[model samples]
Target: MDADRVNTHTDARSETIRSATLELAQELGFAKLSIEAVAARAGVGKHTIYRRWPSKGALFLDAVLSSHETILEYPDTGDIVADLREQILAAVELLARPPLDGLFRSLLGEAQQDAAISAALNERFIAPQTQRTIDRLEKARDAGQLSPDLDLELAMSILSGPIYFQFLITAQPLTHDYIDRLLAALFAGLGPRP
Candidate 1:
């Protein structure tokens, strides 16, 4: 094969592995996924898997990035509270699913152990999506809705933390009501405490 063909083939093969990783994660989950299973599912050799990703964790992260579930489409409706409420409600709905919630929890644990994986999640997954929400907050501040002194990062953590806490603590049936309750309480104390 020519050099271009070789590179193309490699890229195609890598995508196949990532696709298999997604299916396997849905069925077997991230913690239970294996290179052997991925290779078998992808109809590729173990060497291909080894060449593409250094570990199952890396492969799983790529699969997650490639998966539809990981893609968050947060909207900007000009009304920050309405926008935030919708975004949080969507997140709650997505995460309430069984394998997805389990997969994210597993990913969080794996992220703690793997520096590269954590960096990947933070950069590719979390950072960009987070910037969208933060941008909305910045817009809100600019529009004089949020207090100018509000810390964007801290505001995000406070907003998401309680919902995630509910997911972690009891895996409760999260609803729009819960999202509302969370936003109500957090936003109450976030700004100048009026």
Candidate 2:
């Protein structure tokens, strides 16, 4: 009968509904996803969901993001070579994880047609991750580990592109050896011209 208890109950129910929506969104493509289905799955009324999220698009966007794992940390070990290698390995490892792979592909697929979703993904996810890597490379450049002219954005593509290429291209599953080769080849090109 109290406001605090009511708010707590409401918050818990909202989280349950949100998670159920994400599960459904992942299994059934976002376009086909419905709030009615989510409410049914969550054991909540349809009106409850509408109150929490105004539209299916908002629900799908929130679900996609909540289901995604946080980006891996970028570390500075003083040696740029070591740090870059670590970054490559971290990225490949993330792509290799199955749930992340599915969610990532789903997000990317959705972004192609939805400008709002695309902007959200870039801002909430990609841009911050890219900026962290870029900052690390800049530190390396300052320390004289890499060329002073290293283009951070291009440098990120250099690190990420091949892993995506393999993951998207080959039907083969990800493996450590495969990841090693991808990062090795990437560094071979990106490393200071020897």
My TM-score estimates for the predictions, one after another, are 0.81, 0.69
Each prediction's whole-model lDDT (CA): 0.73, 0.67
| lDDT, candidate 1, 35-133, per-residue tens | 999999999999877765677876776676565544366677788888888877766555556667788778877878887767766766666667877
- Any idea what lDDT model 2 has? 0.67
Residue-level lDDT of model 2, residues 1-194, one tens digit each, is 12221122236787798788877876775667888899999999999877655556656655655544354667777977667667666665654555446655666676777666566656655677788878888888888877677687797777766666666766466676776676566646745775
Clashing residue pairs, backbone N/CA/C < 3 A, model 2? none
- Superposed model 2: Cα runs more than 4 Å off: 1-14, 25-32, 44-58, 67-71, 79-96, 169-172, 190-194
| Candidate 1 backbone collisions, by pair | none
Root-mean-square deviation of Cα positions for candidate 1 versus the true structure, in angstroms: 5.0
Global Cα lDDT for candidate 1: 0.73
Looking at candidate 2, the ten consecutive residues that score lowest on lDDT are 1-10
